[model samples]
Target chain A: MSSTPSLWRRPFLPARILRWPSGKATPASAVYEHPLIVRYCHWLNTIALFILAGSGLQIFMAFPSFGPKIPQHDLLHVPPKLALGGWLGGALQWHITFAWIYIATGLIYVIYQFASGNYRQFLFTSSDIKGVWPMARFYFFRGEKPPAAESYNALQKLAYTFVVLLGILSVWTGLVLYKPVQFSGLAWLLGGFHLARVWHFAVLWLFVLFVIGHLIMVILHGWNNFVSMITGWKRNPDYLP
Target chain B: MVEPTNNEKLAHHLARRDLLRLSPLLLAGALFIPSVRSKFITGGLGVGDWLSEAIFRRNHLAPTFSTSELTPFDQFPLNTYDVNDPDVDFDDWALTVSGDVARPGKYSLAQIKALPLQRQNTKHICVEGWDVVGRFGGARVSDFLNLVGANTSAKFLYVECADDYYESLDMPSALQPQSLLCYEMYDQPLTREHGAPLRFSLPTKLGYKSAKYLTTLRVTDVIPQKGYWEDQGYSQDGGI
Candidate 1:
């Protein structure tokens, strides 16, 4: 654990990804792609999600109706029914309002992702689908890294792709459940109302898992990766043969 | 005899060695992913909406108005409504209660408000992130339920609006102590732009369940009572 890098693809699948730069004239390291626009949107997305999550929990606390358990009780040992008092209703409205913002930023991020043509790097390739073992053993057993590649590594690509698609699913489902009348078309497009909410909630846990893992990678990689996300400039590390 | 100047290489070699040494721990970690998640690893600077949002349910059974600090509220009546054609006046609005009840009729705003009233200040919470401590004055849904009369066979109350807006709750949820057929908000009658004339609120539910611009109540007994979300993927109960 101490010696190995913090984040590894683990080579879960059998396929191998394209290796690092083959015979490159320049350095054989990853170039930072997080530009200013992306950095700003990323930060905004983070803020929006945090507010949405906390407030969302409060909204749930307002109404302790379904499921065998409530997140509040599990986390705080304080039952929503008992802890929320009567104002839970108002708290729910506020949560809903911010939820809109969180959702809107998410929208902008998706549009930018597609429009920027950066999505190509995130998509899977035949090599990534198959060359994972070499990559994994290389990463784990100190074998060789694949040839220098483009944009995202297979692992990062897979994670990013899945998250973006999941974001769409969650939002679509959420809207249908949110305003069945005003967005009746969306509701029908999804299915009905209740079902949409179910899909939205289920996918929520996926992002939570993503968030947890994303944090681990940042800590392991150190400030270089994180600081660059904010300042949008990373002094490339010195490379040697 | 010289050590590698490249820390990453040394680190890599050391990591492989460590992994070989800590095979058992790695195996365990792989088996129970949650253990690692519980270790409190997080990314990003300590800032913004995403963090708060992480804790919230993705889709809210709540309304999404006033999303940003830059937002300005166009407040009117508590139960305000946006008229369908802009040709209608809100004061002439009425509430109609039907389905499995002794009485099924549209009671004008005055008639409904005159029946009974209660006023209390409470917080309005949204799933996004915000709260407002405002006073609500309105008739208890239970009182109105009693007026039309409750049937043992009926297990839910469906609130319908003029613009096809609709929401429903289990009889128990609808008749809960805080449930109301609200007419006044903050201190004034519901403005047309607000959900005027009257709106419905089940305090325990999210804002969406509040069903502004309420015009009718339909009582019925059914399983999987369909609402906007029920058709999507949200659970029908929507408690949490």
Candidate 2:
């Protein structure tokens, strides 16, 4: 091995001790958590998703939806002031520019997950399935402590995996819409161009909901979650062993 | 000799340098904000349009279909200022060629029809997420241009429609094999609903670029005018 010290061996912050009446103690300190690749991917995804959402809203406003052809009376309109790109051409420009970036970053994230065997952290086992209720109870405040979680809890793994799948769906649906004739097979498989457009719009809303949930969880988890994402480190005062 | 542990070094490296590098990127990203968005940044769209044109090529043939697949002519949307402009008399209706052309006069409907006929059953894609395959028959724009002795050296063609609509085509797009000056649809003469007498058919462009009810075709070296919708912020190139 090279002379440079391994990344995991970095010194952690001193543990904060919480003494219990029954002589129990817990030590919390900043501990290395996210990898550099993970942090980069996370931030990249965040930027791309936000841009995509806004620009997508702009494009959606142009046609609005599939309905009875009644001239300009389409339902579900988003005002231009609230949307990015301002105009259809501008929106198209933004959407296409960032689409490539979004796709490449997501691909890199997947490659890193498989190549580094980090996919295991997001894979829930039978035991994890069994622990769901207990974990839920802990979050619901019925239990004193949460069940053991290494990298992610079962619920988190499920949500993350679902979001990743949604990302794939978004890209696929977008492709079908972008070049319906060129990828006619994919468009046909998705039940036609109109249906593909619907799926693409639906997935965008799903991403919006996912972002709201993610932010709420980050707030609930407090500074540790935020700091770990930024610095790839976490402090757990309740550390065991 | 032992140096600092890897995590400590990583922590220090991130705190001191990565944040510094990332700040610029983040600041640059803020330029995408709506209120602050600039052409300097949006210039990428023009770049993308240019790149797409280069890769896809103006001469690229759009997929054509058999006549059986043609969407009924009546189903095609009629989008114009005046569907039936009172000023346009069919008997007097002729496409006038001027500017850089050697033949600077009007060509009657019969003359345009007699030039050389090319037909295509191709998808007419609208920007508003709808498309219809229609069988359009007409003279190839290139053939018509050569017939009028248009300066093929010109950079743009300013197409003015009888309905007061206007659009300019890049020289290459104007010369595309699929580009046509169409007068017939579904094996019959076009109705007023479609561009009758004649309309520019650029299957390579979105539906809007096909100026309908042709009044004038001016060959020019520069883009002297913008299309009605182009002025309203539609893409000038109008490629897919």
For this target, which candidate reaches the highest lDDT against the unseen true structure?
2
Model 1 docking grade: incorrect
lDDT by residue (B31-147, candidate 1, tens digit) is: 257544223111111122233323333233232222232122342113223343333357577777778888888777776677778775543533322234445679877777777
In model 1, the runs with Cα more than 4 Å from the true position are A1-32, A65-87, A125-127, A131-148, A188-191, A237-241, B1-240
Per-residue error for A184 in candidate 1, Å, reads 3.7
Look at candidate 2 and tell me the lDDT of residue A139.
71
Say which docking band candidate 2 falls in.
acceptable
Worst 10 residues of 2 chain B by lDDT: B36-45
Fnat of the models, one by one? 0.00, 0.14
Please report, as a residue range, the 10-residue window in candidate 1 chain B with the lowest summed lDDT: B40-49
Give the clashing pairs for model 2: A10-B7, A10-B8, A28-A236, A28-A237
Chain A, candidate 2, TM-score of: 0.82
